[model samples]
Target: MSTVVVTGGTGTAGRAVVNALVAAHHDVVVTSRSTSSVHGRVRTVRLDYGSPADLEAAFHGPDAVVHCATSFTGVRGGETELGRRVLAGARRVGCGHVVSISIVGIDRIPLPYYRAKLATEKLVENSGVPWTILRATQFHELVTRLLSGLTRPPLVLVPDIPVQPVAAEEVGARLAALAAARPAGRVPDLGGPEITTLPALARSYVAAIGRRRRVRAVRLFGSVFAGYHAGHHLAPGDATGTITYQDHLDAWVRTRR
Candidate 1:
């Protein structure tokens, strides 16, 4: 079994990747800023991405590294610096393969987070390490989280744009599988089984939670929203995931009970 290290293994996608790796019987080690309760039999280490020493220590002796860590806001060039540090540490320890999880159509999206992801991708490509980049569309849980935050009592405001939401578990499984195999650079993008609108997703979320909120579609004025509306973030040719948005909602509602 190969030893694999997953950064940000406590977060949604990271946790799913860790679980899949453990189930595959690989020696898995997860790193985060702080210790948390992990589900499976795996090792957790404290890793501060800003500290090169800590990053190298965490990356030591790993056969492969699946990079799932990302800053949500991508402010102050933090994400780019983190990516550089990860590459540096991986190179210092002579890690074989570095698999990076990126977002779909990040190159087409002009948002701050998407820009940061693109920068990270460039870093991995030039890091001189054998690397594989798997770009996936937005996750279902992210859509639900966005909708939940916009639920203002009687009205649920949603952006008027299209999205293809994939399951984090599926993305994680794909990352794990890639980590085990030979490094293939820039694989096919993964997306949801169907293309859906934001308003429909919000309505489904409201119905799932049994809320009486009126889902309203609002036209957001921004380049980011324009890109989303233009379907730049979709993978029409690469809808590889099988989970539907309704399936995600059903599972989410069941968890709340």
Candidate 2:
């Protein structure tokens, strides 16, 4: 039986990947800083990506490894370091393929997190190990939250930006498929069915949830605005998602209602 190791099994995207891989009858092992809600046919391995020793042990003997961990609170070099450590461990253990999930528009976004993600991609490519770099758009849930606190005095000040967000579940399925196959350097970018602007998305979300709030689109006028207008944060035309934003939003509303 081929075994696949998931590095961020507790995250939104990683959990979905684990479930998809397990459903396909693959032996799956998950590694995280702490234990997750483990399911049947999934074994949890405790690992902190910064520590090479733990990474080496968890990565050893796996057929393929999927790296989905993100260092949110650490220093600027944290994500890059994690990627380096994971790749080093994978190569040492003779793992065949490594699939990494990355953000779209990371190179031109100029955000600290995006910069780290971009650096990590280069790290994986130069690691001398077979790898797949899957760049995906924002998740629907993330966009929803960004809109949550924007209402102020009957006006919603959402930054003007384009987005094609995909559901977390779809991304997970794609990652599992990538892990089970050979490295595809840079795969087609994945995004939602329709492109929606940030302000419009916020309005739609507010309306759907019966918030009775008026969403007022505002132009961004700073480094952040420059990134927003540059369209560096959106996926290109070649890659599109099967699920629509409306479908995701409706489902999300149902879950909360």
Winning candidate number (lDDT): 1
- Quantify how close model 2 is to the true structure by its C-alpha RMSD in Å: 1.9
> Candidate 1: where are CA atoms >4 Å away?
36-41, 73-75
Global lDDT of each model? Answer: 0.90, 0.83
Local lDDT at 126 for model 2: 91
221-253 per-residue lDDT for model 2 (tens digits): 877569878877777684467877778789889
**Candidate maximizing TM-score:** 1
- The parts of candidate 2 lying over 4 Å away from their true place are 36-38, 73-77
